[model samples]
Target: MSTDGRSAAGERAHDATGIAVEEGIRSLLLLMPRVVGRAKKMHIPEELQSFSLAPRHLSLLANLVFEGPMTVNDLAARLEVAPTTVSLMVGDLSRQGVLERRTDAADRRRTIVGIAAAHEKSVNDWLGGSARAWRAVLGPLTPEQRRLFVDTFHAYERELG
Candidate 1:
């Protein structure tokens, strides 16, 4: 007999559940590097080449471009990075004219970030390219399968929390 109202065989079953879960997680971890490599091969716009932002900054820009303006602290929280990192990214983007910072009308002390007009075209182009690439990858799947796969991915990301 085992504690926690489980028999010895029950404990083995519980342990197997954990091992199987861990195995699935490890498999995803193994694929992570390859996914990143494939993503890096995608074309980037000439405008972005001069800025040379890292993957994190690119992700930040994507959020601002698509989701509308956000403050440095809000962006930092969303990206799960340090506030200083966001501040630095925003400063660099501001200088590169990829981002514009303005004082929030509601709050004078807060600075909100928005994608600059010059960079919007590039941002939209990148999003379109990414969508095409994803469609290519998922095109073979049935619509139901694609929906299930996307839902599973979101569940996994939520589990990270």
Candidate 2:
């Protein structure tokens, strides 16, 4: 045990930035649940409430909502998942009438997926709160800082895996 009140293992938890790793872990543990709970409480637009969309679907929808139409390969690349995985999600949403799939004009073999016109507003409304919240938080950050923040999140996610 150390005078700092940490066990020897804990005493070794200092990060390169000089902040204790345990402190960062404690802060995130206290903060993450509240953030996730608030996000889970966000209202699903009436038109979308029937689809029973899950969290996995959000990243896919967000990509389409923010970046416009793209092929499944593009979405899979951006989502960092297998193309078959994205294809299944796209197929499911398409059947639900939440997504539209059309052959890419530039490549007949390729299909471009997009939010269905009828559901676009609903998807936008459903995701708008999160987008605004992220923008509000990240807007003031320097580009480098924003990159670091995002990279840190990626590192955390990979570590979890």
Candidate 3:
């Protein structure tokens, strides 16, 4: 047994792979902050700088940008947030002229939300950098490999929760 109470045999098995859990953890600890910092530094378009958007808005906007218009309930499902929370975000963005809410022709009572035409280009520009980066990083990976990478990130998030 090692001083840390881990078995020497177990440690040796990891060492043989040249990637022990401790080493991976240490690398991630160093890398995560840099990754987040770089993401934070991604340029916000001049048109959007005044809105003071937060991280929560990014996911919501990305969904609309990529998937086109959808109702608040649909957005809530995609975001894994409450409908009320989505409503509040939609309302705020709508008031700021960042989003447009329209009465669904199919359902008179339902409202479909989308990026306003005036702000669409700015929103796309803001999100395009991250999307391009992800595409460049993941494009070479096989579909299965991409799935595994995303699953691993989701597992990490669940652990933090």
Predictions in order: lDDT = 0.81, 0.90, 0.90
Q: Write the per-residue lDDT of candidate 2 for residues 1-161, one digit (tens) a residue.
A: 34566675765577577767566676788999999899889888888989979887999999998899999999999999999999999999999999999999988999999999999998988887788889999999999999999999999999989
Candidate 3 clashing pairs, residues 3+ apart or interchain: none
Best by TM-score: 3
For all predicted structures, in order, the TM-scores are: 0.62, 0.86, 0.88
Tell me which of candidates 1 and 2 scores higher on TM-score: 2
lDDT of 3 by residue, 26-128 (tens): 7898999999999888889999998879888989999998889999999999999999999999999999999999999999999999999999999998897
The TM-score obtained by model 3 is 0.88
- In angstroms, give how far residue 49 of model 1 lies from its true place: 1.0
The positional error of residue 13 in candidate 2, measured at the CA in angstroms, is: 11
Name the runs in model 3 displaced over 4 angstroms.
1-9, 12-18
Residue runs of model 1 more than 4 Å from their true location after superposition? 1-34, 128-161
True-structure lDDT of candidate 2: 0.90
Question: How would the candidate models be sorted by lDDT, starting from the highest?
Answer: 3, 2, 1
Residue 28 in candidate 2, Cα distance off native in Å: 1.4
